[model samples]
Target chain A: MRAEEPRLDAAGALAFKDHLREAVRDAPPRVVLDLGAVDFLDSSGLGAVVAARKFVANGALELAALTPAVARVFRLTRMDSVFTIYPDVPQAIAG
Target chain B: MPRERVRFRADLHAVRDALIQLERGAVLGPLTGESRSVILLVLAEVMNNIAEHAYRGEGGEGSVCLWRKDGAVMARIVDRGLPAPAIPAATDTPNPADLPEGGFGMPLIRVLVRELAQSRRCGCNVMQLCVDDDNAA
Candidate 1:
């Protein structure tokens, strides 16, 4: 699922979490979140992404297409090492 | 550029809007993309800290004043809410293998800004952040 919004900050973190929960209810074996269009991601958003991983208990939560700003959050927090990051959705899905 | 100020409510939504306004303003508008992102990230962390911790997730009024001079962008955020924790010189990076859900804000702020100072004055929390021109570092 791609994040349509330009920003995934504190204001949108909770809603994003809720949406992710709903999206994976059927428990797919893997979920790849495409964040190509997301220009910004604050710590709250990063936290939401981390929390979303827990919801996919039976599956994996992978991230794709991190824009520079979003990538910065993941890198600085060392979350880049935590999530399976891919250059794009196709690569993430290919894995 | 001259100092620019934005008054906003201490809520996530308002904070986001305030950032948009500031980013488009004179102080930040002409910065390199890398520099702009650094300034925005640091300010967002500081403001969100005020909204989430100081305001206890409740809404309150606050202001962000910004100035770009001396080869740096300086920001001062003021809010009338509970005081925040001390601004540590360094913060530990949470182990990602633990899948920690939170605690990235302070460390992000610490790494992105050139200088940070937090203090409470007359029942208000004031946070000052300085991002150098060569923020690409």
Candidate 2:
């Protein structure tokens, strides 16, 4: 999953949710969300990530290449504990 | 002291533009990139909350003010729509893959900002948010 732009706020979040939903529709067991390009994240963006995980059963959603800004959100929310995070896509894919 | 402030309608369409202007204001303030990131996140959550609950699609009913004091970035946002709700207490993000789809705004605001005060005064909802930047001089 590649986030298209820098800021992911309420306006951008809906499209993000739709994108993730499309990925989840016929996704495999392991899913890696590539967030290297996203520079900012809001609650709506975070909710979409969680919602995408819900849409995919068995907790298949994994996060990769979190920028400092994005990483702080998951850390502040303590969401880092919930998902498998990798430093980059290659690491996540290697697993 | 540099001028740092923003004003916008309480419309969903305005949120993105307002945030962009707010970011420009934040860059001129006494904040580092990291501190500005925190401020940006708080603004996104709170401003959208106003659009969803306070304005309820009624544009121009909400306004925001920002300033720097004692190394802390402060914001006071006012809205003439629905009364603001109490920010929820944060707990550990629930595990077990129980991913939530909604209602993550308030939690993010509380965790990111240091001084947050919300109240209803004279039929208007006022929210005061502050995030301290240690590197500010």
lDDT tens per residue, model 1, A1-95: 88898999999999999999998888777888999999988888998999999999743889999998889889888889878899998888888
lDDT for position B6 in model 2? 72
Q: Residue A80 in model 2: shift from native, Å? A: 1.3
Candidate 1 regions exceeding 4 Å error are none
TM-score, every prediction: 0.95, 0.88
- Candidate 2 per-residue lDDT, tens place, B21-123, comes to 8777743344677888888788878888888777776665577788878787878888787887877656344443455666556666766677778889999
**Top model number, DockQ:** 1
Please tell me which predicted candidate would have the highest lDDT against the true structure.
Answer: 1
**Predicted complexes: DockQ each:** 0.76, 0.54
Give the range of the ten consecutive residues with the poorest summed lDDT in model 2 chain B. Answer: B90-99
TM-score of chain A of each: 0.94, 0.93
Best by TM-score: 1
True contacts kept of 1: 0.76
